[model samples]
Target: MGQVERAALETITPYKVEVVQGNFVSKDQIDQLRAGMSRQQVREILGTPLLTDVFHAQRWDYVFTIERQPLAPQRRRMTVFFDDDRFTRLEGDAMPSEQEFVAGLSKPRRNPRQVPLQASEEQLLAAQRDPTEAPPSTRTAPDPAPTRYPPLEP
Candidate 1:
């Protein structure tokens, strides 16, 4: 191979450093997007929505979620409110239906243990002995750690 061809091949190799364009979308661009579009157009661009309204059946909400990735997916939610089979308003935040809210609440969450405060040291020790009783040291944090990290190397 010629010198120029060899150099080109070397530059295009697997281990060669390549410039990658950043995947970034501004908030303005995201805000400009609307929910309602032809099925063909939607499919061509965004594919499908995470969820759709059943009873009301006026809106389709698309949730772009990216997990454990370098760049987070542009969180875009579009709500299309319609009137008499025509698009009326294109918005983001809309009040969830009662069924949706109820379904969300079905998940159980363990309540945190509440420790009592403003009590004497003797009361704290006595309370610690019983599981039901609350401790007295809850009034204030005893030893708070520093907010910043330790000194860095030069």
Candidate 2:
């Protein structure tokens, strides 16, 4: 291909896909998991872990990672250690609380800019009226009464 054609193709080519990988766990649940808790209790609070190996049956790992374009990536891991079937301790990165997590996802609200030629009251009323109230159709109406009945001679 010529230089001009090559340049055009390169410019038009689509951007690469964002890579997002790993398990996600909330900080609230992690905080609830304390030392001396049974394996079952920890599981109930944190759900099944992402990694569980036969060699490390006593240790459960919860790993979460996310990556996207034009935004900083996030990664977190929570490890729960067990000694003789009871939780010993947890070690991982600090995480946001449930409220903070939710707040982060919300979009900022801004006052809408005023524009000329706003819709008149009449137009708004007309739009609000139900569209189902259209002109009557020529099609015949369905029978509201039922004709089927149980056998008289049982």
Candidate 3:
């Protein structure tokens, strides 16, 4: 045996698979999958799923997850949505649904309105002070209107 082959065999760990690599299901394979195929056929071809939604009986999902640990976020998720036991939609960083993709980007979340939490008179006075008077970091604009707490009736 060659030096490289000998080293590979020696360093081979239980977690690592040697010889024939695992097959990766491609878009072509998923496209070729036909509708009305029995559950047995689907299972035989694709193997078991990472997740299965029990809420929807008609839809079946196949998910592939890849975790990349880095300083920045690395998201690699593949979800294939099947309708009537046939592939209808696929979502992932690689392939995104045209219909749902546009809808997702259309709306952006609005900033929540800041409400004055319950505060004593001293706290309220401090907040109303001029921003320039306070330290550079401590400078904060005063609320447009102070919260009015109703006085107790005799």
Candidate 4:
């Protein structure tokens, strides 16, 4: 592409919204899981599972995915295994702590400009006019005579 075309393309990139989907299971929530916990207890801790198959009723899958521009997409999955409707074990990718997950979602802005809450003395003085100067004269016009209207009942 020509230099002008490249420049135009660079200046007019499309905006892509950040998309977060599926269950987000934090490390803390996973830590709460126990080998003998019931399905209800597990649900209360980790929320609803993203995928569950009838053929594999003993397994519950939690998947999380985030797609954001300028950064590579991220996806994580965790599976909870159960026997006789009792929690047995879990297998999946290493999960991030709640703090780390939240922190990773956004980056702090660099060098934010500080705004002054109060005006400086120079600005205050500049806004005020000389005390000795007379204020501008105000002119008032005479009011027109009021009109009389007939009574509606008459």
Off by over 4 Å in 4: 1-12, 108-154
**What's the lDDT for all of these models?**
0.49, 0.77, 0.53, 0.88
RMSD of 3: 21.8
Per-residue C-alpha lDDT of model 3 across residues 73-128, encoded as one tens digit per residue: 22334555666666555555453444543343342334445897799997777788
Query: Which prediction has more favorable lDDT, 3 or 4?
Result: 4
Q: Decide which is better by TM-score, 2 or 4.
A: 4
Model 2 residue 130 lDDT score: 65
* Tens digit per residue, CA lDDT, model 1, 98-154: 465335335343344588658898877776676654554554456888799977986
Q: Is candidate 2 or candidate 3 better by lDDT?
A: 2
Q: List where candidate 3 sits over 4 angstroms from the true fold.
A: 1-24, 69-154
Cα error of candidate 4 at position 69, Å: 2.3
lDDT of 2 by residue, 13-130 (tens): 4775666565567888887977899999998998888898799888998887766543566778888899999999988888788787656545344444578778898888778866
TM-score of each: 0.29, 0.55, 0.32, 0.65
2 versus 4: better lDDT goes to? 4
Worst 10-residue lDDT window for candidate 1 reads 17-26
Collision pairs in model 2: none
Q: State the lDDT at 128 in candidate 4.
A: 93
